[model samples]
Target: MAAVFATINNIAKPGCPTHCGINTVSYPFGIGRECSLDNSYSLTCNTSYEPPKLFPISSDDFEVYNISDSEVRVATLVSYRCYNQRGALGGIIKGFDLNLNKEYTFSVKNKFTVIGCDDYTLIGGADESYVSGGCFALCRKEQEVPNGECSGIGCCQASIPKGLRSYDLTLHTLLNHSDVLSFNECGYGFLVEEGSFKFGGAADLSTNYSEFVTRLESTVPIVLDWVIAPNKSCAIGVNICKGNSSCYDVEGGGYHCKCNNGYEGNPYLDPGCQG
Candidate 1:
């Protein structure tokens, strides 16, 4: 299969580099190789530094922040666990990984959030069909947490399954924060990009887990969900789509590519869809 396209329209066929300061590069993601339509969506901008950086040759801590058409957002890195002063399981412990190899996944619209008060979180991916889930934020008091509501007390959320490619994040702390430690000692988790996150209180958590990992990049941003084709299935006649562009099959598998009626743009690139 291997077709997948979302050069996501905005016409990026002239030379690529559709903006950088605010991030925007529609055309199979792009950055080099004539602005990508291949090379597995290469991207690297790095304008020599000082506020000019985009990434995705696949790692460097993943930064980019938005890409749309099917989704792309990034930020990646946040997972905490803290408690000491005899509460045990003391300080530091952060983990994160996103991968995005099989085309893309990790966007069941996002969930799997967790915030302290005896936090309980464990993102998925060791293979269990595809994705996993976690949540267990218990609260005993601290006014019983109710600022933005994550639904397990201090905070919690879960739901992510479709065909995740990779996952990481593991933070746990049950009796360690020792019943909320006056106002949450430390315990955080990540995987957002669905409404951008909103749940504040418990003093926004800070018992010094290295200053809450420097604010988790302004609090999470990861959203991913892509499709167009890469063969998780589909073989038969093998049209795959071209000119008037069209294809089907997709749900947790592969095959997407569209653009018909009146036409649009990238449908796997070429002279496929226009208007």
Candidate 2:
């Protein structure tokens, strides 16, 4: 739903190819060009639709939410668990992974949050480095969770560290709701966008509610931050920005161009911003 824009001042730096949907590219990210560092660093802007979708390089399914000077938000699937009459879980989940590396890192600015009652969830796995955490929520009765509050009662959230490239999610139920079986029978878990979820009493366990009815329609939004490799800034002192342009270092490494303020247009190409 966020609007996408392209970089101005074509400073002739290595950049993603035009057909690869370069028009929709933004700062901190590029497509198909040496400026992208490698293939995995590029973004794919699909134009099949009206506004088009921006997909991270190497990712088959995932829509980019927003890209800032330091981070990018993406949409990913959630994991769920349900218990049948016999008290056995009726669902199975392998887990979710983001797959980031030295070239890219997940943002610590956001948190991995979950919404639901009678559920225990874990979010882990960052490049096999293995640091993880989770939260549990118990809603014995519908009235326990107050409206607009997340106090680990009916809904809870946890924070993740910065520099992680990937992660996995697993959900489990601590106790069978056979006693309150008629009221609540399922648990849900997923990484949610920061500040996007709010606690409400209405979400508590309810007999009239079923697992199918609680399933979320869309995946949660997760954010990631990327930077050029450290030791790789613009051709060391070569003044990469030729012809009256200025070079600015990207967060991690490499550099971008600007038309020396007062000026406009692609600094990398042709007419360099006329006053």
Candidate 3:
């Protein structure tokens, strides 16, 4: 990994540390109480783990993978199914429930994908009242479908809803894999950040693919859109913008700060925007 020079001055408090390894901590997001904007932004770092692990406010739900200015990516389990030659399943369905706060919204750039010779996946939200999307793929013969093509052959994909806060997924199959069970006996599905990955090769459509996936990343990267809040009032000090700085209210979560013409170094920090 290459070293990235950390810029964008103190979005958090002056004395607080701004990073957990390569991940940066900013205002509205803090490792502990001293710098956190609110309860929703508190994070925990487990030093016991070799590389150190970061957890979000929803600790039990998912593991925090990375965080950017307007987006945070988390790792979740993959929804996979393995069947015997006789088409018998030895496990239950897999997926997640995500009900995010106003600070973050799902980016519309993600796609829900399912992979297998026989796969039908449904992704929805909050008791099915709302849904992201789903896909159905049935490849009579693995050879009939080309590798890396998500054209509803061995792989399928669908668009996700914008600003979606809640999400869930379920898996279904046709012929229970009694057909096309030769090389393809199992199935896999996931939601991934668009353009980061593409469908796999012919070997990926095989019965052994389930075990192969375990050797790789189960979850994929995703984008989240965040913003500063409107109710925030810098006048009364509920929101703060330091020296030579000005605050701009946006349509999303929190107000944004910008350094004046002669300076640039994170306007939210004290002694901000030094030339």
All candidates' lDDT scores? 0.69, 0.58, 0.68
Which candidate number maximizes lDDT? 1
Q: Please identify model 1 stretches exceeding 4 Å from their true place.
A: 1-11, 18-51, 54-73, 76-134, 137-184, 187-189, 192-210, 213-215, 218-223, 227-248, 252-255, 258-267, 271-275
Which residue pairs does candidate 3 place in steric collision? 227-253, 227-254, 228-253, 228-254, 229-253, 229-254
lDDT (Cα, 0-100) at 176 in candidate 3:
78
What are the RMSD figures for all models against the true structure?
13.6, 4.9, 3.6
Alpha-carbon lDDT of model 2:
0.58
Best by TM-score: 3
**Per-residue accuracy of model 2 over 58-125 as CA lDDT, tens digit each:** 77566775554445666655566566677676554334555664655666666665555668877777
- Compared with the true structure, model 2 gives a TM-score of 0.71
* Candidate 2 positional error at 154, Å: 1.5
User: In candidate 3, which residue ranges exceed 4 Å CA deviation?
Assistant: 1-11, 127-129, 207-219, 230-238, 244-255, 258-262
Instruction: Name the runs in model 2 displaced over 4 angstroms.
Output: 2-23, 27-37, 47-50, 92-94, 179-183, 204-220, 230-275
Question: Which sequence of candidate numbers ranks them by TM-score, best first?
Answer: 3, 2, 1
TM-score comparison, 1 vs 2, better candidate: 2
How much is 156 displaced in model 3, in angstroms?
1.6
Sorted by lDDT (best first), the order is 1, 3, 2
C-alpha positional error of residue 14 in candidate 3 after TM-score superposition, expressed in Å: 3.8
